[model samples]
Target chain A: MSIPDTTLASAKALVAPVLDDTSRAQIRAERMSAFVRYTLLITVGFLMLYPLLWLVGASFKTNSEIFGSIGFIPQEPTLDGYRKGWETSTPYTFGRFFWNTFLIILPKTIFTAISCALVAYGFARFEFPYKKLLFASLIATLLLPNVVTRIPQYILFRDLGWLDTYLPLWVPSAFAGDAFFVFMLVQFLRAIPRDMEEAARVDGANSLQTLIYIVVPMLMPALISVALFQFMWTMNDFLGPLIYLSSVQSFPVSLALKLSIDTTEAFDWNRILAMSVLALLPALIVFFMAQRYFIEGISTGGVKG
Target chain B: MARLQIRNLEKTYTNTFKAVHGINLDVADGEFMVLVGPSGCAKSTTLRMIAGLESISGGEVVIGDRVVNRLQPGERGIAMVFQNYALYPHMKVRKNLSFGLRLQRAPKAEIERKTAEVARILEIEPLLDRLPKELSGGQAQRVALGRALIKQPEVFLFDEPLSNLDAKLRASMRVRITDLHKRLKDQGMSSTVIYVTHDQTEAMTMGDRICVMKDGHIMQVADPKTLYDRPANAFVAGFIGSPEMNLIAGRLDGNSFHLGAQSLVLPDELMARLRANSGSVTLGIRPQHLRVNTADGLRAVVAGAEFMGHEVVLHLDVEGERVVAVLPAADYADLDRGTTVTLTPDPGQAHVFDQSGGNISLSTSQ
Candidate 1:
């Protein structure tokens, strides 16, 4: 394409009608502020991500290079740390540990979702005796510190011969021991109009059927959020598994990662960082994948009317 | 098909707060009875009691020959279309229509057949695959009606089902529901419908008999024409008509009603009833019954005039009382604000209520 037969002066005039000095100055000022704002934001963003960058860089560096400077670029990158992290100084590999974590997380997440949903449905829909009292107690439990009952629960589990087993980690979820999930699900259930359940009841469905068919399907996003929350929290749990699972063979990734750091001698910092990165991957992937439902579930469930 | 009887139906909350006082109503088989009132009148509560959704505190709900007060909502053989149209948001229209029958363990073919029949009847067959959220308000309402229809229940309950629609859609849907009632009767589906609404227009149009309620008390139960013509009290008179009846407090002296500086000669029958009560009365005159002219009547100042298409409503200040008169637009279109006019109430159409608002002039012969 060729330009139209117009003088450069006319082209300039066409591109911009003349502006008053104050208006031109205002435009310049707006551009300057926008440029400054973007630059500041980008610098702050980099500052916040510096630690994660250092971790990723250090995972591929030798221990000497890692401690050489605060800079994130590795002098020499190698797969040795990943190789060593995959096969730790234990009888079982990280693969087995990942499997162990999954064993605990999958069932715990499922149990939490199912049990909490049923409990929430009961609280939301039914007019049972002491319903308000029970719901109030459930919310009150949300404010109770976990450390308050930790010792008592540990002692009870030990007395039941459930020590060194995943039972201690996942069993409580089957009974909706997580008050937060139950509370969240209850709010979600309440946001659902009573009309749907009433319609179901009029359609000849019993209470259980109404829960399964009407309430549960409408509650899918919230239930998925509950499952995702349980999965991530269970995966990242350190204190619980450390308290119960003493045997190295039964350890989850969170505990196994702790086991690899040798404080008595020179620690394999690179290998530890590599394994840490690997451990975070699953949670990061899960969060990114399900964040839409997580956000929607929270906003929708939190609306009272 | 069954006759429904509510014998002294009462609903008390926490054994103290009486939401619905004891009220008796008999809805014959195939009758469309509308329980209409202002908000907090317990009209919805009354319908729920009949549907077995709300447990009656002190009454018997009998359907056919069986007392159904102890029965569950589903077991009472009633289907309800809720105010919000309560279509399962996640389900397609077909599934919504078929769900009730499916829950009854009906055969798949029968459920399909009935759902198809209802869809055809409602002209929602093309919308069968669409979810509730995808449909318009009117379509969602049709699906709600279809869901209730497919159940083939003995009784139908509508809790202000058209209240959520736009005014135009509401007017059209009102005719649709009335036509549905007629169609059901013609089809030998003698299902009794007990609809609850706060809109007097819906009560006047859709109901075979309108039960007017106030503060949990039954005010009157009559057909639309009777309700409009012979309201039982000032409350019913003011509630039943558009723009409401002009109820002005006055004293009856012989055959004349003395309302401030304005005087009206009371009808002979009403004068007798007023004589018997012998106290201040609320003289009820509907807007259409009041005529505005420059000739012989109570002199008044027209404060404002609103042109409402075919008719004009003039806001008149008569003896310091704000009275409204509906006049034909073609005849009174040029009447300006601040104009002086004489207002005359048609004696035949006037009503006289005693100080307590009871219609003393509703003759016993009627």
Candidate 2:
């Protein structure tokens, strides 16, 4: 029939272009489009990275040279900034600040990792009385402004005689005070099929064993994300350490970086910038190493209705 | 190997939505029992309760000599293969198969040997080092079954294990699983299998006894032949066969079954049982049992015909009621649409159900 032939002709006509499209003009147009897209992406990427590039470049410049040029390439590069930055005016060296920061960050990361995972596991896997209400409260805490609770929390800590210690910073993490990580890990946990855990339970594993063997191993990517995030956040936490740590010896690198600038004396711009660059290294290394896990953790699943 | 007993098992979710009513079942040691039903029939829920994956609202689950209602899933001595296979994506096949044994702190060499033995049996030896994601769907299902097999539990619960597979793969896997059950039994391994599926074909092919359920209640439980030959009610009669039994609403008068503009004399035994409460009833006949070209039969018009290679299914209309009849394709090759034909139900194969769907033979109460 003409109807059948006409339908066949139209179908073939629609598909013919894709099958035979390698002409020079088409190739040039495609290449030009791709080239434009890449060029735009690269320009945007460079603009975003310019501040970091400038910081690293200015770290090696003299104080006067840093102000002279906003360009990344320093006129004359020197290690004097590094040398001077490493030696704090305090009797203790910058090594103590680095060590103190680790003391806060390592424990904080471990605590946040364990507490958040446990809380997220509870939220994701089980149905208990008031579970919905409790979870809603947890999410509500995510929306709560940190400044709203800051004064009351400080007063409570002062009442408990924890005024000038890392306890105030790392202790709350033990209770799963960071709701964002708990929420992210919970989403990752919920994405996993319940059958695996059921299989584990049937295989004779207890609740804790199921969590450790079945849930934790599958939750590794999200856990790594939680730890990486907690580490980066605690490392860069200036206000928390500044508020609690009174003694110079107890000061973390965040407080030490701010302490490097004597307002009465010259600003010591190059040394401060050099210390800032040094501070950025750990976070940078961590992010690059486990960035894949961080991205997978947040984007995997759990938003389905 | 153990006899598993579920007495009055019930599951009620929060907000008072009942997924499973009280269900009673006894699965003998080495029995291959299949729970077959449509979606929302609570077949999966019943299987989950038996596996201890779901908490029972009210029931007693006894495995062997133990009342395991309060016991944990691991303590129930059952292993389940889920519909999605539930293979741990991170673990290698060897690790997934050996996880349960390792969890119990089994001897390392024993775990290795058992893992290798199951891998060899399932023909997944080369896949021992590959992750679950690396395996195809069929391969992952084999690994999931291997994980359950290596445990050597008293009972194996399969929740639509082949539903995720393609038709060809599903057929092959069905045979493989049945063969595995036979081999395990022949080897004196006491393996009781309880499988659940929404497909009646799977139930008929794989189950030693099929339990047909609907709306959280079992309609009937019987072997494939008995279920096909004699269903307890209209639901079972209609559900257990493909193209479903043609169930037409009718009235059962003293000695005749009357439809819209058609009537058939009732067989003596059916008439004797159904004469008591002879108001509204459903007359059921399998498509294969409805014969065309009978000397004295109801008149029908051939509405459509489907040529099914060996057989041609002719959709016939009697007055306004649609009835289907299967005829040898070669013999009925010239049957045309809109042609008039005579259709009759084989007297011995017809089924009559009361208004409430209970079979006339079994329900004689007025």
Candidate 3:
């Protein structure tokens, strides 16, 4: 958003002094800009990861140590809570919960990315009847909250007797195509000059061929971003599985971890804290694995993340 | 080799934007046709429609012997070079060149052979292993060309391909492209080509015949010399030249045209073109054709001078209108700004246009 390199280029061009004239101001300007960029980068870098660092440290800390300290890293670290969270008999059933979450997330991430990218290609590169209408409808759904349609979706799934299956969790997502992701991808696809697609087309590619051979290959960044979002959301989802899935085996990790709230004894503070840390792992892993795709100004989406 | 026949081609977007109006053109088996126009003039749009990239709202695009309007672009057997050289960022130059071949399931050795051949032709053999981002603008441009060239399609469409290169490189590339055409012709490959560029110089130098376009319509189509010498209309005359043709308002009063307080004898051929119009007519003349004479024609006051190394362009104010005279650097040695000189108009080189900007050929009626 700051457009530093571009701004610098334009500024250097537009603000050049007369050839015979020299000023200290140019050097000062260079030094000032470099200083500002470094300071801003370091500040934003710390701001982005400091909280996550604290959470990781807290996850490794004992309950007493966590409560007593505000320092980032655990002074005395232990993996006992992680060990407790990984056990099935601990009431939280953390391992099974993680597996359940992953079951939805793994498929959801892949299918959502494919569907969204496919639909986005259709929207971006093709012209057909009702194209404007279809695009408008897709964009309109972006603003429509899940809650507004959740009740109806629940009833429909129940009537089909799919309420207990992962179908209701991951199936709608496949068709829903993550409108935001689709929209993001569509925008990225639009930025690509039609010439590449034309070159593909003239070389004997049909629409699908162009999409696969040219368009999809070009949209790697956007697709990865869409995949990352779907992975995180599916892993951390609380509401859909909560309402539709009733069976303990079908419950995702987010819902299963909520079982840490005690119905019989005093509130299990250690387990709650431990389960939260374990829950953060999937998203952290996802972000780390997909960080390479989040590079900016690479002819795809000019997004940093 | 293929003939490209476009008959009554039209493209209208759903948003009610009509990019290309009805257009008709036919190319011989290996004719090099260049489409020249300003931006948004529908030249590229017309090319895309022919390539089947943009769906035709109305018209027929016949390639070789097949009506390919509804056919997919790939089946049309054409390759295109784009302005920005839209190379695959993830792929090396070799892979970029061979992408289409691979997609069509060509044998690996054949792909390698074609890639190597194209790389060698473009002198990019060493850079084939490098990514597009690592290449300079000229290198990237050659890669795009090599990618298109390796396909060996029946038709080649260049969409402002040299617009991205620096001045020196673009000039050199044009010569190389012309050389490539000759080499291809010698190889007995007679592919039809349609190149699109807004640069008139490129069109003039590269085209066998140029189709001058304006506002989605082909204004004129002619060989480069004819386009320069006998422009079909005022628009074509002005559009085809650099430092553009200077058109001035004048009156056709008898056998000679009157400009301000000066009169030049019109050629017998052009004199017959003057109609009995109620108002003033416009006179069209190229700067290079106007010679500085001391004895005849309109009195011009030199206003400015642009010394272009080889040629010095002497800007003149004649009858409250600006006209430029491009003379060899030595010719203007004795002249300075504000030097009053009479210019001799060469009637044979003059183009007469009516108020509507249409060419009115003089038939020597007088």
Candidate 4:
């Protein structure tokens, strides 16, 4: 092959070899695709992150600045909200609210882990009569509205004379297991090939033995994933706390955060936002702390459905 | 270690698909019994039934003196290594090894001893502390084996344990597993081992007795050499060898038989059988049995030849029928395609089967 007789200037003046229709269309399509992707991503990302950013911004703002306009940064930032939200609030202090919530959610999380894991183990490994039917029932509970359970549960609690205590939320977790959590665990369990369990069985492992030694360990990602999920969910649950408890003294952080909403307290924006940020602490700490486990778990067979 | 007997075992699912039809097999103590077939032949299902993993739908699995039909796998004294090397993913190799011991509530020191011994035996000591993810495929398989070995079960069941390994590793592991069986036998641990594999090489290389299966039915049960040399049916003959046995179609008429357009005389006994019996008979010949030579013999055309270092595989056109023939390197050094060659099958090397694929004695093969 020999070069065409063309000068550098002539080559420079040429029209990029007059790209074939295929290459021209490909280049145009690639550029259009890149533009659309970024536009969609940034637009949706901005919308999702906007409210969290606003909440953080409000946490630092004074009452005056908060009411003025929504901005990323306050004109004159102040720590009065933090002071008031953290310690200077009303009848039920945020510290006490924090303690109460900590006390309840802590026990609730542990109970949820235990009950969910045990029930999940049963659903995952065992093959008794009505096994599939039992599993189906557990999954069915996840679809029913939470409000439907509220009235009947409240009546049961009313008859038991337990309304202003954390027993209502924490006790149930010890009994029937979190259906959603169990479902996630069951998926993870199912993914573990039966060979492992069979190997264990030959090794003298009965059903419970297999569950504890082989099956449970393989499902760590899913279990920790569910535990983390449960921690965040229970920490932020307000409706359950509201309906079950009456006294402000026994309120969780979520119910405490809503205290401003209940009282005629000038709609305490500074305190509400500060407490909102504070309420996020458990979720954030939980998510960040177990985030790697969380991601690993969900990316595993952490039955998202 | 004990004798294992599967007496008319069956497996039927809720969908009413009977994966394993009722089949009976016996494994003598210390014998390596291989159940081999193509995929979906229920060889694995049959193994699972013996392992107490699949609920036996209709019959009892007897091990030693006890019938283990209702026993859990743990209680059945059977250990199984699976096709996927299903080690517990979150557990370390040590944990995987000791899991069964721990389940039995064995003392810590004993569990440690056995775990160490098996890891040493499998050459997986360095992997004891690493999780399943951290180990290589071969190491994970060793850990799965170690887990089963540590249990000290009476029967060792392997469900294509080498299927997950690469070819090189598979060959190496095959040797190791065979050595382990030999060592176990020498130590007087008379366990009846049942191995399930689709790979004919594994079955041929490892099994004391290979039970060739098809569509949930046992085609034949014979020692490896016998299975290879005298397969009971067309499926077994074709399935047992890599290049496969060649099956050529022919017909009977008077003294000479007609194959394509050529005439070949039958053995006097075969002619006598045709005179006595009824219907058509099929002739089966292994690839190695049919050789192309320059001597006066059965005539064939040279189709093609594949040169393997130690040997060459010649694809011969035997009267318009393509059949593979293996020759030693020296004989195939200069064999060419399209040339006329004399073909010869070693007497007593070919098997005769009826049209239904059942083997027949030469005296009755019609």
Candidate 5:
């Protein structure tokens, strides 16, 4: 018994060192794999972000330095681009163009949210005579290319004497012309349980009241996504404003960016880059501010169903 | 005066699948009636119809003096507590409680008073500022109850309100709801409740009277005592009790109950209570009523024995039929598996049913 006990103790002592050595090896291997993974991720991420970084860096450079070096950093940064870019060749400043963009975005976003939510709610919850057919047509419009309707829409806007105004851009979205947003909201609404809506109805709320008090609050995330998409899209929309507004006073940032190129024989690279950065600012800021809800809306709508 | 009456309530889906056959029921004012059934039994559908959430294909749902079949849910004068609590996710508990009153454009002071009163009664005052998601399951359920309570509607509907809780919480909530109903009644408030659940324990404990349903039809409607002591059919007998009432198929000739290869002389009391003289029958006996190790009883082989602290549940095989007998643990502690024992069912507690699933022993037993 004593010999067996001694042998067992010796055997345990021998196995302990081997186990420790293997675990240490395993830890080192895990650390190596993790290091490789993070290094690869950081490299790819930086590569994808290089163009935006270069844009910001080149905006501060002089026109000569912007063309002279492939590197982003400038030897001497100056505020010349912003100062000169603000006062465009056109009579109005960049401020006027930004304001014009805001005017289009504000009504477009607000109306899109309201109109899309109402339409989505009806499609999701109600039973109408032609509901299936109507919804199918709505989806069909989503699948149709925007170019297909451009000529017809331009003709209609021209006949209405709305070519020189922002009505063509704002009126359609105000009437839920963005079928994609409506479809997104409808899908989101379908994922939500209707217990609270039923509870509201039981609590003496009419259909509209239930929509306002119960459905809208629950749909805030999806609604925020719709508003953000509309705001960004309208701010960046060049073709819609170009086709509708031919006047320099009503040019938005998207069309205004092209004004400098069209007016000057030799392009001032720094000024254009500066205004491009400023034009990108509103969309970037808004996207960051509402990023949490945007991701949640898309993910929950897709995954839960 | 808020008596709810359903006259031949029917529900047929658009696919032409008839979910509910025309069934009539009458629930008195202030009665705590429970609709209990297995899954797919349309108990929840019936409750939804009463609340006007589901379209009644054919029926007159008369609440008080009004025919509410055509009324919207909000206009039906009924408030419902849903299974998932259904508290407004965006509102605080106070707002949730006062939503119905605010919708009615009641006085601001009245809304405040009612909100506070309901909060105090449900013991959710501390959670008044919390959102529905922040509250625990029990707290959310209380808030849901307060939402319905504050409405002061003519009738209240609950669609398996406690089913989402764990077993322990469900048991406690069952008592809480029953106590709340009693408290409201004592205060002379109109608390006509139509609660639905599939758990028989909840139906047995919480309901003033239970309406047992099966496949969209009412199987039996009786107090818990009558439902247990004398189930109207084999389905009710099998569904009501734990370990279930043993329903063994056998035949009866004269005064002898022939069970497969064995036979037992029927008790005089049972023989007198029999509706049919001599034909095929299903013998229904509760586990507790089966006496073990009697000298003059039918022999059974003990297939299994579970020692449950104070009691022992013996799974026995009697003439190729499995029967469960619950006996006192102390007396049967030494009983081993595959042992032979005699089981004598108490004559007074045993029930006999005919071929059509109707209790034949109930008439003379009562």
Candidate 6:
């Protein structure tokens, strides 16, 4: 019995090395697969980002060198594009157009945040007469196409003698006219518990005071998301300003950028690209600064509600 | 501190479902009254109506001398602590405590003093600068309590404030809250409190007087001792105790109570206390009062025996009905299942109920 047990122990020792060898091979294969996966992902990610990179790089290139080669690298780098772009073909520089854009965006973003929050709070919390009908109509507006309302809205603004002013651009937003934003905020508000609001009421705060003190602070993340979206969308809007502001001085960056392309006989590709890169900066910077809240707001609003 | 009078309060939803059916309760100043019931019994709804948070459908809520059915919750001079400890998530503990004072436009120095005082009372001074998210569950609860206490409202409403805590923490917080109430009363402050909870242990331990509710109606309002000793109905009998009072369906005739084929002679004291003499009845016996292995009693088979350290709970099957008896551990070493035994219920502690569920064995002298 002792001799047989020694033989069994030797046999077990022989099998242990083989098992270890197989596991080592498996580890090697897993490492190789992970390397291949990361390589493929990096290649695809860079491919998607190449256009933006090329735009930024080409912005620094001389006008002659911009279309001369497919390579993004500038053989001759110069600030001539920005220099000429800053002094637009029109009398007002790009600074004036940027300032004009800011004027339109400030009130529009601020008003959208405040008005949508109020409307969303009412819809989410209170029960009023015809509440269901009113809410259904509000959601119906969400499904309605923007083009369907553009003509009637333009006619209304024209009759009001508001066609040549920024009032036509931002006044509607102050009244919670953006149904999409109102819907977003309403869905977000629905996900939040109402105990805090009730506590505020029990603490002797009236309805308006509750809205201002408790509701607004808790709604900050979603409100920031709303403001960010409104800011970026208004900054990039071309048709609204083009239809309303015919004056050269009143034109925003969007229409002003178009004016550069339209007035000149030969298109200055480098200058347009440079101005486009500059126009994209504000939205990009603001988004990065508020990236955490923007993601949190959207995810919580969508998933929970 | 002011008395709260809820008169014929009703709550009917838009779907025409009546959740609260005109219940009346009067909480005296400085009394810690608890409204307790199982889920869907509208205890929270009743408390909300008193706080002026829910609209009164058919009754008046009087705080102090004023009818506050038309007043806002804030204007009703009341404060509430929610089950979730509804501290303003953004505000620090100090700001949360002073929010009511700030809303009232009180003097800054007064707000500071009141905030500090409340923080100290709740032992949350060290947590004053921390946001609600930073505090632990127990700490957050204390901060929520301070928020209510700082208001010093005429009445305080608590909606299962400690139900979220673990068992051990819940026990500790229960004592803390009752102590706080006593301290406030001793200081001559207006400390009328209406607390709502579904946990019977919380209702039994903390309430000055408990109001048991069922199906949107009050079952009994009595002190914990009286509620245990003399329940008004079968529902109250089964609800208030931990192991629950075993209610056996039987008949009482002459001086004997019949359990199916078996019967036991009723004591003169129990017979004298009986309001109904001869009819179908429920014989209510608490587990502690049921004696096992008695010579002259109802014969039963031991279905199960649970060793609970100091005591053993014997689950017995008497004929076809289930009965439980609590016995001292020393009395029974290890009683095996299927063993035959006899359960003798103490006559003085037994209760008899008529068909309509009213306790018929309650003596008017008690």
Task: Say which candidate scores most in lDDT.
Answer: 5
RMSD of each: 3.6, 5.6, 8.8, 5.0, 3.4, 3.0
Model 4, B111-174: lDDT tens digits are 8898889889889888888978887788878887787778777888999999878999999999
What ranking emerges by lDDT with the best candidate at the front? 5, 6, 1, 2, 3, 4
Lowest-sum lDDT 10-residue window in model 6 chain A: A296-305
For model 6, residues B42-72, the per-residue Cα lDDT tens digits are 9999999888788889988999999999999
Give candidate 4's error at residue A219 in angstroms. 2.0
Q: 2 or 6: which has the higher DockQ?
A: 6
Per-residue lDDT for A1-305 in model 5, tens only?
25688888999999999999999999999999999999999999999999999999999999999989989887799989999999999899999999999989998899999999999999999998999999999999999999999999999999999988989999999889999999999998998889999999999999999999999988998998889888888888889998889999999999999999999999998999999999999999999999999988777773220
Scanning candidate 2 chain A in windows of ten residues, the lowest lDDT window is: A296-305
Off by over 4 Å in 5: A1-43, A302-305
- Write down the lDDT of every candidate, Cα atoms only: 0.88, 0.88, 0.81, 0.80, 0.91, 0.91
| Worst-scoring 10-residue span by lDDT in model 2 chain B | B269-278
User: Residue A104 error for model 5, in Å?
Assistant: 0.7
> After best superposition, candidate 2 residue B152: deviation in angstroms?
1.4
Residue A82 Cα positional deviation in candidate 1, in Å, after optimal superposition? 1.8
Residue B66, model 2: Cα distance from true site in angstroms: 1.9
Model 5 scores what on Cα lDDT? 0.91
Show where candidate 2 strays beyond 4 Å: A1-49, A68-72, A302-305, B267-277, B362-366
TM-score of 1: 0.92
- Across A181-226, the per-residue lDDT of candidate 6 in tens digits comes to 8898888888788899899999988888899998888888889899
lDDT of 1 at A41: 100
What is the CAPRI rating of model 4's predicted complex?
acceptable
For candidate 6, list the clashing residue pairs, or say none.
B1-B190
Clash pairs, model 4 backbone = none
TM-score of chain A of each: 0.91, 0.87, 0.76, 0.83, 0.92, 0.91
